[model samples]
Target: MTEMENKAVGYTVQQGVATITMQSAPVNALSRAVRVGLIDGIESALSDDSVSAIVITSSLALFSGGADISEFSGGDLSPNLPEVLDKIENATKPVVAVLPGPAFGGGLEVALACHHRITFAGNQVGLPEVNLGILPGAGGTQRLPRLADPATALTMIVTGKPTSVVKLPGVFDKISDKPEHLLEDTKQYLASLNAENCIKRTSDITLTMSEEVQGVFDAVTAQTKKAARGFFAPLKCIEAVKGAYTLAFEDGLKHEGKLFMECMNTPQARAQQHFFFAERAAGHVSDFDKSTPERSIEKVAVIGAGTMGGGIAMNFANAGIPVTMLELKQEALDKGLALIRKNYENSAKKGKLTQEQVETRMALLSGTTTYDDLADVDLVIEAVFEKMEVKKTVFTTLDKVCKPGAILASNTSTLDVNEIAACTSRPQDVIGLHFFSPANVMKLLEVVKAEDTSADVIKTCMKLAKRIKKVAVLVGVCFGFVGNRMIEPYGREANRLLLEGASPEQVDRVLTQFGMPMGPFTMGDMAGLDIGYYVRQSRQAFISHDPTYGAVADRLVEKDRNGLKTGRGAYLYEAGSRVPIPDPEVLEIAKQEAARLGVTQRDDISDEEILVRCLYTLINEGACILEEGIAAKSSDIDVIYVYGYGFPVYRGGPMQYADEVGLGEIVDKLSTYAERLGDYGKMWLQPSDLLIKLAQERSSFAKFKN
Candidate 1:
């Protein structure tokens, strides 16, 4: 046997077979080194007299996750992915690809380029380039449709989601009978192939547009438009796929490359890609790493049995871990359990879960009515009321009942985590796992680090976040942590805009056009107007200084208009519908609130002014957050806002959007607003010092070394 080694991949000949193994550990990112090695390895195998067949597989690593995204930040390198893939597809000898795990995006493109592809039952493959706001540049959109059903291929490309090897029939030449025997299956598959049959290329396959396929294209295009709405990449992906059917293979490849470049240069692409890295970066803690040991949280307990608590308990059950739901009474416990069952059954009805799978997950959850039931739990998170005293009582009980080293978490969105930690004897074990409402679904989890929280606790919770499929953004303890704190100024401005001049519909229209899922007024109405009224009462200073704050919302609730529940709030809802219709009555109420609060109502508020005030105030608060070190890095704040607050994903959260809008522009706009509003603007809307510095220097939060 002869061996040839490179930095990222190796070439070796054993018997009549040449094996090219990728050496990048973990997810073998298709970096420049790997591309060079792949081209070199294939050429070496072709030249060697002893080598009759070739197999490309990773060396003790999961299959490639696609392009090395970090490399994207730099200039072009030699032998790009397309060049490497073309070398593989055009190889002389029979080439086989053995996928060990997921082959996503460009990685799947590489496998598609091989003459014969083989994988295990559980292995997945996809061209998910649409996620990064780009279509597949290296022939993925072109070649995938050549082998698979065009609609299926188009669906996979448009959605940017991985599919099981078995689910995609024509794509893989051979599949392992057992999930663990992919290598054996590939060897047998290679043994069956000779040069006469093994040298087939995806480019030679012809694709034709049929009536059904055209229908699929139309349906998917419409669906993508509706679902992704303002997104730029998904529609581009469909266009690239359509090229595969209309144009020749080489032409399709060229078109795909053009589309890829077009999407890559888009601001939406930059924003989505920034969020991709930001979400991953949020998991890393600067002070502690692998050396900081994490405690096990196998068994969990969630106190309270309401919507938040029940949803919190479901996350553990879904992960196949035992969870105890402890309410003060049996009735509450049973009601919570029923809601959890209903949620799972609904998923089962939707085919998202099998009946057996639903039962299996439900079996992992149990309900109890005593604090003593939580003693044996590894972690206990209180999902009770948001008041400080109520959280203290829960922590005090948890401290007395929970085992030593057990984590005590509070699901308090606006209260101090440190004060709750102070009520416990084990302050080091206390942290905040603040799951957003409908906890089983929302991705953002603010891991609030209290004053006395230990590194181990942080590490454990961070690790646990991965298990539960949540993006854990570590934040210092403060009022409302990151998401709520930032939203305060944003919501404040939107509401104040209502009283000053802008109608509810006008403010909402401006924000939605700026790419928020919904404006603050719509969100407040859906969340219930009374909720804001009570929150305003709690923060007397938060509202007292600014008389216009919460005035419309307070008056709406006083009229028994509590939003969707009451059929009226900021906007009136027709019976049995959630579509908020702009009511003249609501505008009249706003005018009255403005008069009562002694705020001057002006008709000159432009849509641009509304957009700037709402988003810029949010950005200003984000800057203050960065300056205070409450958020570890600026990107973390971006991730929290995008995932937690429905701040536009394509705009890359508040800070990234600000950087794109020009920091200097923001400083000028904010300064102008402060001067225009006098004392109120100076007190509330002044640009943070960090924003002034970054803007003057023409720097971006995305360019930060952290």
Candidate 2:
């Protein structure tokens, strides 16, 4: 049969099934074309005697990611997704949906309209509209409850956890061999079943609720409260699912639509959606096209078999790439190898990896004390102690030993990539691949490009990052690059706030409430206070000579309060657990430091002030980075923080959150704080010119993107 194209839809009939693929590109977003196509496809399927069943799917990665995001903001407006789902619900003939991949939001609603649904093993299903700042508008709240229990459906919809095919409830007919083969399996399953006995529209099924359901609902609500904090969509999603149990199917859908629309209009949703596209846009480099071929890297080499070096080697080996690790002595190499083996054993015990797979990865790794082993490697990453002289010496050696065209990279977090490149003959090959702590687990790689670094080298490193399951952000060379540079101000503000009388626990509580994983002090303990102390000492020239500069940190180091390690840090720690205990000594030190600096302190710090001081400091620095062209865009900064740091995903990234908070408000607050403390506060609270410009124009930090 010929493919029919409606302005709002695309239709193709094959065999006995009429397959309707949503053709909206990029995200395959459901708009007017999708709604009209859905209606027309159903009509065509019902009219044709040859078409026994209709299978709805998408021509993209998602069946339908969600409703058209643009439509929520009133661009190319059409009869919304719920009305489109209504057409599907009222169809006469049985509709079988073949969900290939993610069927979320209106996508899941489209599946619920069908009589039978089948998906592949890797397919992930959800009513994740809530994540985008909306509820599932098209029959999701109503239909999902009928398919799964009200509580399970609510958790899936509210939390936005993708429904894994292996763990899906018995509602879906079968799991197909491949995503593309879903339609065939669905059609065969439909033909095999008696039409009268087959399950029809989700709206026709009665929802079941029990005491277990009530308990699940209660438990999930509590968890969501703790997890989501003050987010509206997750809580509102719970209310919509509750409607499914209390009201009729259509009535429940009405409630869902109302809640969905409310979330769509919220500032939080707008910020989150901005982040959604920004992350996807981060890898785009206008100067580098797809023609720059990535070098074939089947093997990797690591110099220095310390903690980071071992982790870096394991990351390569885990990705099935052979890795050769070099250490100065045989004993050091043996210890590193032993640690790698222990790590694999622990992973296998935890059921994270099988014993055989762990052994397989271990077999791929080879360690040596000599640099000669790195001679034939395609890529070599240096992870020695953070000193420029040591780095230069190592690269200078590698330059002589390693073959030509080999990509040499560094795993330095906060160093000048250009200085490191100067040690190597091929500066274009030398790039900074700053892996977060415990390199094997962390998902971020800061790919720093020095001034003379080649586009091909950047491209290869990005591809390599993806191959190792890491999100790579191409950045320019700077003192701390993206993550740590912005983090400096954030940490500084947190410390200054403590000097002004807020206790460690109080500061942690406020930041945790604001949706960070932990406050600065708690994180300091976990990371070891000595590292920061060393960095502080190293950068003494950059810091103010005032008494507050390193007084408290130096005192903490002196007292053996090096955090978690010494059983004390910002707060006291028990023997085993990380649960923070309040310490009098530290409190006394903070008070003394406040007095010594001649800074007036407040006993009670409001949550609002604490949040603004800590967060705005980071935002202010991000604006400066944008103005300096250190970061190409505000979104790039967000990506760096979201992946590298523990920034909350639901709140978007820091920059997006700042945008939602209003640039003008932040600038005014900075000026207010600056006016209060005069010179002392001026250094920390100095508002960036970008922030002032954005505030004056009533623009957002996100608009600074290239």
Q: Which structure among the candidates has the greatest TM-score?
A: 1
Best by lDDT: 1
The clash numbers for all candidates, in the given order, read 0, 3
Worst 10 residues of 1 by lDDT: 697-706
The Cα local distance difference test for each model comes to: 0.87, 0.82
Task: Please identify model 1 stretches exceeding 4 Å from their true place.
Answer: 210-212, 703-706
RMSD of each: 1.8, 2.6
lDDT of 1 by residue, 13-68 (tens): 99899999987876788888899999989999999998998899886546788999
lDDT of 2 by residue, 390-501 (tens): 9999999999999988999998889999999998889989999999988888888898999888888888888888789888888887889989998888887778787888
> Which 10-residue window of candidate 2 scores lowest in summed lDDT?
70-79
Candidate 2: C-alpha RMSD to true structure equals: 2.6
TM-score against truth, every candidate:
0.96, 0.93
